[model samples]
Target: MIRSYEKTDLEEMVRIWYEASVIAHFFIPASFWASQKSTMKEKYLPLAENFIFEEEGQISGFISLVGEHVCALFIAPEMQGRGIGRALLEHAKTLKGKLSLKVYKENERAFHFYKKCGFVAASEEVDEYTGCVQILMEWEQVR
Candidate 1:
């Protein structure tokens, strides 16, 4: 089941974000992700409109949107491939109708997933923080 995020889900959301980020962005050091946990919990999660995917009373994935930008989407490593991330993304689309996001160019799985979900890559930019190439992707709801 998918629903709006509650304050109580903050910790679980951060944990999934940390775990999935490490696995998906293995090219980056794990310490980088670990250091961002507090920021995800206190800064990003609180600032964005968050949606969570819960089953059996536990949240396994979530998506965070800042205006039209998809700031984050993450599924726990063990819970991926079950369509939870897709479901959270679809729910987000219903809220905003159009979306834009950046994906690390090296994360092929996510780049292709966004493509499969109808996002078109618009351009690439270098992320100054990590020195990785990021693809800018956008999606518009069909009229």
Candidate 2:
């Protein structure tokens, strides 16, 4: 089931973010995600609108949006490829009408996934923190 995030879901959601980030961004050191944990918990997640996918009473994945821009979408590494991310994106589209996001250029899985989900790469820029090129992608609602 998909629903708004509850405060009780914070810990699991943070864990999912950290784990998925480490796995998807293999070029980055695990310590980076570890260091971001507090910010994700104390600042980012709290400031963003979040939705989660729960299955069998456990949290499997989640998506976070700051206005029309999706800042984060992650699935527990073991639970990926099961459509949870697509479901989350679809849900976001229904609410926002159009959506945009940036993905690390090196993360091809995510870049292709977004493309398959109907997003087009709009531009690219370097990420100041990681010095990696990032691709900006956008999806517009079909009329």
Candidate 3:
């Protein structure tokens, strides 16, 4: 069930982040995981107002949002492809305005996921940390 993040869930959340990063290493470097963790905490976490996802009563996966931008959406290695991410994205659409997110170009799974969810590629740029080209996608809810 999806709900707001609690202070107690930080550890589990970080674990999910690490696991997701490791999975991403198939296309990027393992070392990038450390930098990604730091960025997630420093740049995204603080701005995030809500973090929610399905938990097996044990905090397995999570989705965090900063305003209308999806700052993070991660599922534990053992629990992905179970509709958690899609549900989170759909929930985010109920918020106030257009939603936007930056995804690494190499992470084609996510790029296509966002595209499948009706987000259009709005821009492209290089990421400073991994030196990977990144795509910025956005979904607007017409009034």
Give the candidate number with the greatest TM-score.
2
- Give the alpha carbon lDDT tens digit for every residue of 62-130 in model 3: 777767777788888887888888887787787647898989888889899899999999999998877
Error of 1 at 81 (Å): 0.5
TM-score for all predictions? 0.97, 0.98, 0.88
User: What are the per-residue Cα lDDT tens digits for candidate 2 across 1-143?
Assistant: 99999988999999999999999999989998899999999899989999999999999999999999999999999999999999999999999989999999999999999999999999999999888999999999999
Total residue pair clashes for candidate 3? 0
Greater-TM-score candidate between 2 and 3? 2
Pairs in clash, predicted candidate 2:
none
Candidate 2 TM-score, C-alpha based: 0.98
Q: Which candidate number would show the highest lDDT if scored against the true structure?
A: 2
Candidate 2 ranges with C-alpha deviation above 4 Å: none
What is the lDDT for 59 in model 2? 99
After superposition, candidate 1 runs with Cα above 4 Å error: none
Worst 10 residues of 2 by lDDT: 27-36
Extract clashing residue pairs from model 1.
none
lDDT of prediction 1:
0.93
Q: How good is model 3 by TM-score?
A: 0.88
